[model samples]
Target: MMNTDDVVIHVKEMLERASRPITEECCIYRVPLLIRQLNQEAYTPKIVSIGPYHHNSLHLQNMERHKVMYLKSFLERTNTSMESWIHYIASKEPLIRHCYSDALQFTPNKLVEIISVDSGFILELFWTSNYGTDDMYLSLPWFATTIFCDLLLLENQLPFFVLHDLFCLSVANFGNNDIPPFILLTFGYFQSLNESICLLIQCHHDLRSLTNFYLCGENKTTHGEEPMATNSSVNKWSEAGIKFAITKAMNTGKDVDILVRDGIMENLLGDSDAAAERTKRLCRNIVLSDFQF
Candidate 1:
């Protein structure tokens, strides 16, 4: 029997060879089979054939509503548990479509649609159970897929989605070292997109601590601290933070558009355009000199 290292190496190698938009058959179905082959301690294969097309066909047929005679017999024969069934179904390539569809089945309209609820979709799509912990393994993939969908479906109002995507990336990197390499690369790709949502949010308003934001979201903003956007000290802190983030983007060869308007930047610098200009020019000179500032 192969060891844990062998299993890991084999999985990594398979992942490397696979192209973008990975297949459910290969990743979800085949990968598990491969792992089970390598290590018996891994999960058991309860059921198979959870591909997108098959699931979509089931949805179109309205099998859930009618509770068909054959379908009952099929379930009884399979003896599949609900949780395991859902997990297996979600491991497929067309998993996102199924997830979104299943989510909408109990919704008001019983139809799949996005972007009609203003920016409320961001909150709904990426809900957190608690404020303190940052275990986002489940949230990340959904966030990424939603952002990609928004880019396609909400082209006109793409800024909000992009900003939300950036927020996810920032929060993911904020307090975690267990992020997968593909997730990191995906974060980098979204950041590089010229009109970044994160920059817009950072520039338009300052970023409060995650805990503080959570509190504010819950209407428990009783901790007397100045607003991120208007407070002078907060503005300065935010500017420095934005500069650092932008600098990091530049170093990584990502295209970054500064979101702070010139007038606002000047206002933040105590109505001193000269000082702000001087600082920017100095930064430019430092860049030209090839010296790390």
Candidate 2:
């Protein structure tokens, strides 16, 4: 639409505004629409809208009020001021924005407001779930389950650095409450979602590594050693004097009732033929990756 000189000027201006290369700071992202469209419900948050992606969805507005309530509690309990937090977060705007994959449209003040409130909510949630009394917003059974599930969706995320910074800032005020380190608290909060949580101690920053450990039940590679993959069935592994640390287990009633916990099969009924029949069908119609799905 322009002449050569105009084109040159546009290119130069664009180069001047180019973003820094992607680094560790970049983690949050929007799911590709191709992937999301296959099962939009699976990717969408049900209760809480975290970060900027689903920030102001009308359906998620209910949680917005709760976020403010949490912020208020966080400020009151620590005797800190939101004004100061907002100002501090404003200074880190560029670093925070870089963490997200998209170019957010919110102005500086709006972005600061969102970051300060969301970060405070998470910090308060971690603290209260660990140290506070039995009575709190999280005590609501349905709300607790739904909100936590929402928090784990890939799109509903904030950079870990922001949460870590807030934790470091306000942790000293927890005052001998016996709160463990921020990472430990975070681990505890999400432990229910991952049975092989012990591996998280070493692989917390690497989702792929953590997922590998989660599915394989052990590290595929150890330091000073070569990469290796091994497979052993649950019954065989258990028979070999190996015990697994599982999140939960259950004994099903008689008549070949299968036991499941959090979508995972925990135990089969003691009837050998019935259990065998069920186990035989476990892989039916499943699209196995070269590795197990």
Candidate 3:
């Protein structure tokens, strides 16, 4: 019904209105609806919420006091004041808000408070995991298993840069150049889960994305290898006279890679139920990503 010139002008207007500056790196994302629909629970946090998306959720409210306690302990240990942390996060409020897919409904003060507490809690948790003494919370069975699982959920994340910044600040306050990087602390905390999987965390935005990258083998090319194609099942490979043997030489704690040579398959599996479940979850998340795109 419209002439070509009229259509061209209309499209130009639409493009101008839609265009905006890409200032924020997408650090937080809503799990694609298609993916969430497939296995909603997989992407949902069960025991804790790390960032604004799930902040103030009723089921997660129980952990709020624990967050405050951790924050207090962190401040005491490092001799850094909370007001300074609040000011730093407040200055970056806009950029931090832009990290999330949805608009944050909290006022500036509330938003800054949320980010400060959450970030501090994460830093403190990692510190305690690596260096604290006889914290009863860490002794709880649920803390080692379920809490670790929640921390890795797609909906449960703080921007990695925020965590990195806070961790650096804390270490500096302690005047400790000997402190290890966040990645090492993270890997140490979760080494019991799956060591191979922890290696994926360095490059991805969040835990869920890291797991997806590992399952998809997206970084294999970095080592001059092609991305792994969907390989035949363990049973199917065995049928072809490929003898599978657990190898301690490559004990990474998860059979994430397969090396087949001379009718033998060296299976480097970790000795943890948590590692096996993590692999299964990675496979599920990959299928969800497939459905999403």
**Reference-based lDDT, each prediction:** 0.29, 0.64, 0.65
Candidate 3: regions farther than 4 A off: 1-24, 193-198, 201-204, 207-232, 241-293
- Cα RMSD (Å) between model 3 and the true structure? 8.2
lDDT of 3 by residue, 1-293 (tens): 75999889999999988734443466677787766776667778877788888887898899898888888888888888887788788888887777777767899889888888888787788787888646697559767577888887777887777777777776788777788988777666666555334245543365444444322222233544553234434444335554443222222233334433322333344443344444455455343222110
For model 1, the stretches where C-alpha displacement exceeds 4 angstroms are 1-87, 90-103, 106-180, 193-293
lDDT for predicted candidate 3 compared with the true structure: 0.65
> Candidate 1 — what's its lDDT?
0.29
Ranking by TM-score: 2, 3, 1
lDDT of 1 by residue, 1-293 (tens): 75899889999999998654443322111223443444332222111111221223432243222223323332333343334423332343143332222122333221211211221222222332111214353246664443333322201121222224333433443465653332233234443232323222222211111101110111222346443331123234345663322222221111122323321221333434344443343233222222121
User: In angstroms, how far off is 268's CA in candidate 2?
Assistant: 16
Candidates ranked by lDDT: 3, 2, 1
Decoy 3 TM-score against native: 0.69
C-alpha RMSD (angstroms) for model 2: 7.1
Candidate 2 stretches with Cα past 4 Å from truth are 1-3, 132-138, 174-177, 194-198, 201-213, 216-263, 266-293
- Candidate with the greatest TM-score versus the true structure: 2
Give every collision pair in model 1: 163-197
Give lDDT tens digits, candidate 2, residues 161-218.
6676666667666676675777777766676656733454432232212222344444
